[model samples]
Target chain A: MAKSKSRTEAPQDASEDVVMQELPTSHQPDVQDDASMAEVDAEDDAEVEDEEEIEDDTQRVRLLPGSTPTAASFEFLNEGHTLGNALRYIIMKNPDVEFCAYAIPHPSEPKMNVRIQTYEGTTAIEALQKGLKDLQDVCDVVSDKFVAAQKDFKKKSISS
Target chain B: MDYDPMAMDEIESKGPVIKISQADTVRVKFELSNADISFANSLRRVMLAEIPTIAIDLVEIEDNSSVLADEFIAHRLGLIPLNAEGIEELQYSRDCDCEEYCDHCSVKLTLHARCTGDENMQVVARDLVPSGDRINRVLGTPIINESSDGLGPLIMKLRPGQEIKLQCIAKKGIAKEHAKWAAPSAIGFEYDPHNKLHHLDMWYETDAKLEWPPSEYADWEEPPQEGERFDFNAVPDRFYFNVETAGNIPPDAIVTEGIKVIQQKLASMIHDLGETEGGENGDYNGPRSPEYNGGGDGWQDQGFTTPYGNGGNQSAWGGGAGGTTPYGTTPYGGAGAGNGGW
Candidate 1:
């Protein structure tokens, strides 16, 4: 049932051909995750008490089966860096953005949440990506021009 | 270190696709297939460590009679994020050949505030005059002070007869070295296709499956949408990034440069790891022994079991790290026979 029949049938008694025919080609060194490989997320009660001190890390935010492919959001802890007007100014420039806004929900926690919404044809993320790209372009142009102007000023100053 | 670059499809997606963005805050979502938490976390790490920006590095206080100490004023000067307009022209002080600093490696900002007469004026970032006509000319406006809309956040109040003279040094650096050097205030990501959680006919707010990030949707109390309990696409591999900039270099530059830097680092790592540990650590990982794969037990999963071969024997190598050449299966492509074989 082999497609390539003319690959030369192994000589009946040839050890080299015998070894070649039995060679395993998809060798993957198994990674070790003692905790995970031992059991899945839903802990089996009988074997659950192994790592008592280590807190079980429960992950959320996964788009499970039967979930909508519509939207996504994220929260970032403000480490004292909130370029509020500047970032908003940049994101709003994108034409594909259907809805987007940033808000600070907590007074105690230094955090801000930014939500970017998109139209039917585009996803919310793509709009943010486009906006980010635009910002990059603007920054790059500014960087290049600043350098060029610096060079010009240096050259002119030296001659005078 | 154990990441499989090939298994990631989020890297191949077209757009992060902005969904909703408010002034100063934006939410973006993208997809990733066959990838995990490491992918998203790595981007955050890169933004925190890789993207370069300019900030005040050194401050020489000539005279200070203000309430703040000399060290405090210097520290304040260091926190100020300058206009990273001509950063491409600047080099890191660590990389530059100059002994201390030059125009190519650093920018100088000098501030001399003397409260003369009777008026007690506040010495602010605007009062700090940046030198180098090149940077100032391109900036067209104040480098750091005027751009950021706050009077006291980065300002120092001075009273009458309180004189402050200082020379500030600006240099290129990444956030990894110091928080003051970081470009982004906050940057994070999450798996996309945000589906609703449900239990016993009741729609829950957050999912418990994905770790590192709990349901971001749970944080807000918004009106439920139609079919919140229905799942359209269960497996979402999209990567959503929320980046808040610190206001100098912007967010997009941070994202683009972060990815580029991470790629460069990975490529360098591969190159560095490819060579043998022969020069110094020869004994630990010297030439391979002939009996290394003696029993041939390791060969079983080396490649795919090709049907074209005689019997159920031959295993053709599939694509993997460094990639397998099209010669059936064996890890010893170059090290075969007498070629570095012991």
Candidate 2:
């Protein structure tokens, strides 16, 4: 089963790589070298503007164009399977979501792309928001229970 | 929201439950029930790599006459867990406003040991004195036999006339950057002990049970019958976790901190998404225009709309386009299957 799954997945991975490679050049060109040299002249004027633009350019999440309400792909910066897998699991649990999956464009780059396909009634964004909210709720409960358990254990040890 | 007793009861029963079987300053064993494997795995991974702790990140040696090399002693010092009680208030050095390091970002520790007498002297974690009152070595409990004097982990030994003097800068960091910053020494996670879910394949010549004995945790669930029909569709919902800390932070606190880290990550992602939602036409083209163009023309034009989208998808990647030619299949479809259908 695993072997056949990999075979079917091989071609798809190749295409995603193409997207990853083309993304950088289109957004921010070779402006860093020019910006650094310009910094010595103005010091604060153009340098601050360049820094702001760079910050805006590196926004953590971006919605890919051509995304419909029901189906969409989102690119996440500086994220990996740690958030991706958990979010996928939570999103898949919602009955409105038809499919949910996440992939890392490349190992070297800390980026994750998540695709969510929802049923007709619900939008992909809504499903994603719900997934994030649900995951947060789960963590809240886990933390609370753990803290309470620890306190109980400590009290038991002290009394005994 | 309307209060429905039946709905409330169902939600309460389905919510995750955590039961701590054993807990101490250095170790904890717990069972997380009513949760999926992915959620449990995330928590475990975060604990191992994301939850921050204080460790000696920089060392400036002024004198060294000990047998160990300077780098070796520095490495050892980095592994020693310091008290991380107020770590939440401490800022990462990179984020701090100070030039290099300050009290807000780091704590200074100095160790000056010399053996002038005939006998050899032992330099341990306890010997490193902290400049701040809040930071110190996490003394091991005598009950665990960690040490007779509770001096902490040994760094090195100095012979007569041998001396070692060094200044260490302990800073907050996560294990993802360096192993020394990890709070847990070990974390064990196990699920589906009977292997009824077929998550693991047992290899045995004659008897599978003999070759692959059930783990101790298997007792928590009933054993499969000799000729019982297995539920192939059953998913493992219960997870057993054993967390052993390195004494910098309490074991129970580590689990909570890990969960909080996951929560923070999700919250941050949600916040970012909300910020992009305000963009025109519901399209986010902030700095990721290249991604937008690549994904739009590259993915959509190739019928890489959805992983399991309907046919006619073949035409999208049917061929003429040079961009699509590099990646023949639908991009998102490949993304879904490539990530092992996560």
Candidate 3:
């Protein structure tokens, strides 16, 4: 039975492999047919290269050049408001953080640049790590409560 | 301010608490107290978009004589929720090492329907056959017959002599990519029932209560009396959530999964921060070391040697939090495992 199934699906699988390989290059001619479209494609290609470069580098978090550890703008690749806003909130809760804010340079780009200025006692990197730890603790508490509540609900429902 | 014993007791009892008021297979209503607005909103957004589910992603039609266009049927197929009981075991198609798709990453479902008699025939999700035992259509109570096998969502109808043959590949994905993979049909989040924080401006003709009636949840707390003084310093710390699942997963599992997603995201960020090279003033030339290309294998190796030198034991992080790799099955290969750090 397994052999029969594989035999029937063999042709379909081969065709799909071809389709996958052709997918990226198939749209190139359509864009090149028009001059303005070609220009837009070129710009898009440059943006893709930028994204690739960011991805290729193992260091997702980088300290911007010409910035001090105490006051710096750190670039976080492949992150958006989900992490940015939450991190900002957690960092701001600390008394040593003088200023903290995050901004996405562009909407299309998956990058979040956070600027942090801390008081003389602490550095921005330390504050950021503390914020991440605090946020994880918060999530742990929430998850535990949720699981306990769910169990209680289940028991009550079964008893009733 | 003096430290009063009564206030201290109040503070001790105010630690985070979750109360489940209602729960069933497909719906759950719960209250989360003592968490700030940021945490509550984050959980809600993650549940709606981040938690992964299985859905028909690619469809190939071999023959279709039905009135509907092939694209229309394919789009409808993508919306049907498949059982995702063990979806975490399945790797994402993009992350899997296959040319197109394999059983490890995708489930093949085929449907062949042909009508011959004079009567019209109806095609439903039950007719589609799955290639593997792990995935199948979510079957709810039958609308027509109670004793019959639970019915699935209707796919299409066919007239006499009309036929439709198709093959669909179901893959695991998050709602962030497409709504078809959304875990919940609707998630109702409410906070500040009395509006003491004035988050919303109540617009009404004469009486605010008459036009905008309070939800049933408002009864959980005392309703504000007429001309009652409001505390401006009060911040909304309690959140109420009503989650209705799309039947791909259980209601409680969705909440836990969402929380896990948030934890994994934070863990990966922290892990990356630990590997960052340049913190010295005026020394950022963009990660000069070509050896640490941030590929899956490179980071996996580095996690063992320099496992968060500053941050204590990597295992203490999100690694054992859920007993699963933080980004083990994540769609983005860049975010996956680094030794003890999930």
lDDT of 2: 0.74
Best by DockQ: 2
Candidate models: Cα lDDT each: 0.49, 0.74, 0.72
Chain B TM-scores per candidate, in order, are 0.61, 0.80, 0.75
Write down the RMSD of all candidates, one decimal each.
23.3, 9.3, 16.3
Position A58, candidate 1: lDDT = 15
Model 1 chain B scores worst on lDDT over the 10 consecutive residues at B304-313
| Per-prediction TM-score | 0.45, 0.78, 0.73
Q: Highest TM-score: which candidate?
A: 2
Model 2, stretches more than 4 Å misplaced? A1-58, A151-160, B1-12, B132-148, B211-213, B280-287, B291-342
Compared to the true structure, candidate 2 yields what TM-score?
0.78
Identify the runs in model 3 with alpha carbons over 4 angstroms from their true place: A1-58, B1-14, B132-149, B277-342
Q: What lDDT tens digits, residue by residue, belong to model 2 across residues B51-135? A: 9888888999999999999999999888777777778888899878799998888888899999999999998777888775443
Which of 2 and 3 is the better model by TM-score? 2
Deviation from truth (RMSD, Å), model 2: 9.3
- Best model per lDDT: 2
